[model samples]
Target: MYLYFEFAKPKMKKKPNKNTHKIHNYEYYTSGRYIDYISRPSAVYIQNDNENRTTLLAEMDSKKLNVNLFMKSKLLINQLSEKHIDGYGFKEESKKLEGKTGLHKLFEKNLIDIDPKEAKEEFKKLENNNQFIWEITLNPGQLGIDNQMVDKNEWNEILNKHMKSLLKANKLDPNKIEGYWALHSNSKYPHIHLGFFEKETNHSNNYRQSGKFSSKSVERFKYLFENSIKTQAEYQNLFSLKNSIWNNRKEIKELFLSTIALKNKQETKSYEALSANELKILNASKVIANFYKNSKSKSYAAAKNNLEVKEAINDIYEAIVENNQKLALAVTKYKQEFESINKAKFSDKYSAGLKDEFVANEKDEFEKQIGNIIVKQCLKMNAKEKEVQTSLNYQEKDLKQDFNDDELPIGLSFYPYKYDEISKLKRMIRSLNYEFNRLSRSQKFQALRKYKKNISGVKSKVIL
Candidate 1:
């Protein structure tokens, strides 16, 4: 139920009135969880041309609204059509229904009361569609121009490139995917909201499907948003006359037709039983994959399953793990390369030089960007090594506290189960410690801003 709507009234040539031409907003979503109201909010706006026509005034990103999916539930996107848009909806809607009504209305209702001293509970009740879910948000003014976002001027070419590449890969028809352009400037920083329809409907909005949209029901909701912005932008002339994005229809269409991460036929592989040799090959491949993922040692992983042919599998695995000591050294080397940049760049004195270098050299810029990925791999390898070392340490400790079952496999302990039970204590300790660290980090980062605010307040007061 994560949704974002931002309005940008033209800041350049055309400015619209925020006062005279007001926007009526409606919102929809299922609510749960206490996301920081100040931190998390989605905005979409309506553009309006002022009566004076001189200022071309508008209220861009003036307000934000948040919706949650657990307690306070909101839905009703399929409701908007030409016949019934409800111009005077909110006042009448609440009288019509008691709780949050539509998408835009949820924003207005949320803004009514605020207790800055505490975080308010917007969630009315908890509902379950439980799984590991994550979300990201962007305000028009706040969203940075990069590869992650479609930069306005650079967007056309980027979109076109993606379209051409995808078309060559999938052999898709441009007409099958429809594209529309809209500039909603009724908000702070002017932004263009381009909508692309897949034309093909997804079967599992009911949940349990691979290759889903950015949001669970992102496509449908985005369309409703797109149409709303289109109507509003056209009425207000939020688009620029000189630098209009209107003419790039061909490029825009290509972007719309580009590959979507979501699809109906998610799994394209055939289902069949594997033979004995095939199974062994699969197992070897799986082990190598897991080792690479867990070890971060590409050398170890590559040697394990370097060649795909049947004869080479064993030889490859042996070659890869030929000597564990050598493999470990290679891992250390790679790990050092990964950390050398960041740890150096972030240091107090050296950081200034690193920053200056970054400004001057594209190589430094590229390295800084990818350095985290290298470090992440190194950390994963270290974690795997720690796990193995911890396991070995526990086994040695267990041997000392042997059980009474002397009749079993060689050094049979006094009791088999007793030895096993005592041995796991170290592992349990490590597991608990790992969880504690993760939770502590989460709490600290989330509240860091609030702590700074308090510190600033204390410093500013007159202490005569």
Candidate 2:
């Protein structure tokens, strides 16, 4: 699943000098929900700092992660890959049992597929539910433009107006389907995640509605949702700049692996008994790293392309990779940086300072391994892409093709700066998402075994 993270951080700013009575200009970091973690408990699932992770782990239970949906999907997909699932593709399989109790029954007949819990299922059963799920998040210590202290209640009202407008413009029926909005007041932003349900089937599993769901249909929903995001009054400010998204499963999988590697490194570097402040830094860093990785993978095909920012991010990333020296320099720079940031005397700087101070700290070869590691990891693209790029570079030097129209450049370079800020946010969000999913999908579940028949690494036993 594609994950989203916040790339921007709020910096110190002055409100219009009304009576010259000013408030504290605080710097803050933020994050967004990952696609997979939709079912995970929102409170802790969205939390990223190590201190909170430790605190939440102590305060929460294993039951809270609720990753059964993810587990079942994995197992079923693996099983079908090995054997043609009921000798039918997913579309035909669904068509076969169109009128009957299809979803849970299909799971029973051909390994189970998970239906999300009561709340999500109930929410989805509403008429045009997918079209009306009003989701918005806020950053910590943020406020509205003096519209009478816009706390969660006030935010709810603002969102309500937008929802009503959307419902009207789209010719939605409020009478037929009951809609409700709930504020997740306990969260950092204390934001809202609302859903409207068809009053008729809101109480039960509506299999027929799900019968209409498919990957292609979901893509359509995504297209509509994105357009709605841009036009919706409440969301316009929040999603003013369209965030980057990765569509291909293979590319997304590589991004997941890359995130895992970065998270491991951050955890290793983190000190014992991390304070909330320190943990927040960790969270911010991970999010920045994540945005950089995901935004760079888009092909030229998607209409929602963010190529300008993508290329800029790539150039910064390439400065570290594509060579042994540049990568090593960055690693060494950050190593000294890791120690320096903790010092009490050093003035606090934002991301640019954070990165510049990193590179400014060193000259010795003896302390450059960490820089090399970071640089090397930066180029971890898909194998096929890497091979193609490498071959193209070699061919460029080996044989010159001279027609102006037919000329091709060696390969695109990488950049780390444009979105490194966002990658930090993505890292923390992914870490929380992964940890939560892992907790719920652990091997002990009975449903897991029903599905593991598909994923177990079995060989053909070809006797050579």
Q: Which candidate is the best by TM-score?
A: 2
**Lowest lDDT 10-residue stretch of candidate 2:** 100-109
Off by over 4 Å in 1: 1-34, 37-211, 214-230, 236-464
Candidate 2, residues 235-350: lDDT per residue as tens digits?
A: 32212111111112223234434543654455333333555443443333332334445554332222012222223233333332333353444444443444443242322234
lDDT of 1 at 238: 23
Model 1: weakest 10-residue lDDT segment is 66-75
Residue 139: error of model 1 in Å?
Answer: 4.5
